[model samples]
Target: MSPRSASVNEELRRRSRERLLQATVELVGERGYEATTLADVADRAGAARGLVSYYFPGKRQLVQSAVHRLMHLTLAAALDREPRTDDGDERLARAIDAVLGLTRTHTTVMRTHMALILQHEGFIQCPEQQKLAALLEDTIARWGAADPGQDYRLLRALLMGAVVALLLPGAPMPLSSLRAELFQRYGLAWESGCPPNDEPPPRS
Candidate 1:
């Protein structure tokens, strides 16, 4: 058989990286942050252990990138959900709900991710994070922000605060409340974007 072409090799490399990222998400979600190791991620990914080191500088960076990828995929899905609308209000609502939803469903993974970000490492400007930023910035622009650049930072700050509230240990806040606050800030209707049931998110 002929040797693999450059494009084929690139595709294979991409797949390996993606597999490792996905595996990290799954393992960390299952076993918590401290318990899950890069070796475990490699095993779950069915890739060589060394491949994890190649794709990520360390386990910390690996988990962060994995979570970012998960967030990007999730926000993308929400944006593309059926009955998609061009209305900025609707799109922004979906974007907010999509991220807040992750805090609820992927609580463990997200909690670990948020905690890591708080440490000295801070935000790692990986490809996955850049994708997330682009989606949010575009969403803010669509919402008719006076300045997307400024609004994007503001929206990001709000969402980060909401996630921290949702994941706070022993005293977690309600997602509904966070969602309501975001909707109010964005001038969105209560019924928009994967709205919660009749019961509202409790106020602190």
Candidate 2:
């Protein structure tokens, strides 16, 4: 093939891949990962199933790509909305707020992430999962000033657990109260005051 033709082909392939990723995101968000099939993704993307396979090899790869893209976009938006400050407590607060805000706005994405975590076979294998873990580790290390290995691991686990609990169905605690509890547990400084909640105050 001529150089010009090869360049055009590469551009086309990139566009197709982007379309596939977008479709995957939409489908996963709407239907959850296990429910979304390659055919559904192809139909949504207006591309052939073969094309998705050509780019991603399998459904797992497609889901991984979509998750990675979603995380990057969401994390960037969260960071932009609440940029990190010099204070460690502020950084932790922002991080907690970011995660909660993301979950509140993008419930489907959070649900998909939870579904992924339950699957032992795919959870650890996906590149997006590794990237998320690394991001969590890096964020904790920066804010906590602790070793990134075990300490960050434990912190990440705690944060994720708190997130899951907040997302649980029919949880008695309100989100605002949950956010405050997280900040306090992590030793974050509250600028204004405790979050608005109907619950009674703790005994002095």
Candidate 3:
């Protein structure tokens, strides 16, 4: 193929992949992973079932792609608004706050992610999960280094468990309050504690 034609073909492939990922996200978010099928995703994306199969061989692959896409979107949002600080503790605190905001802003995505991660053995085995876990472990390591007594792995578990708990049906606490409490419990200052107008401004 000519270089221009090859470029166009690659672009088309990229767009098709993005559409498939988008459909996976929407259907999985609405129906949960177990209830969503490749056929459903193909219908939602207006693509042939064969196209989805061509891109992702199985339901597990589609769900894994969806989860990875969701995580990327969530983390991108959080990182865009992340606070700048040199101190390890301060950076960790800001990260916690950012993650909480992400969870609140993307509740459906978060729920879908958690549901997939916990209930689907395939998801647990996916490479994307390993990448996410490593990122999280690195974040916790930064905080744990600041406080030698803190267990990084344990802290990660607590934060993940806390998100799940807060998302539970009939949970008593409001998201905002729960967020604040979680940060404070980890010895981080709440945004409310900042001086008037001194809170880190939102990112553009």
Which stretch of 10 consecutive residues in model 2 shows the poorest summed lDDT?
192-201
- The prediction achieving the highest TM-score against the true structure is 1
Candidate ranking (TM-score, best to worst) = 1, 2, 3
Candidate 3 local lDDT, 78-97, one digit each (tens): 43453544454555565555
Alpha-carbon TM-score of each model against the true structure:
0.94, 0.71, 0.64
For candidate 3, the per-residue lDDT at 81 reads 53
Candidate 2 contains a number of clashing pairs equal to 0
Better of 1 and 2 by lDDT: 1
How much lDDT does candidate 1 score?
A: 0.91
- Summing lDDT over every window of 10 consecutive residues in candidate 3, give the lowest-scoring window: 192-201
Q: How much is 100 displaced in model 2, in angstroms?
A: 2.1
What's the distance in Å from true for residue 16, model 1? 0.7
Model 1 root-mean-square deviation: 2.3
Q: Summarize candidate 1's per-residue lDDT along 46-91 as a digit string, tens digits.
A: 9889999888999899999999999999999999999978899999
Overall lDDT per candidate, in order of appearance: 0.91, 0.67, 0.63
Best-fitting candidate, scored by lDDT: 1
Global local distance difference test of model 2: 0.67
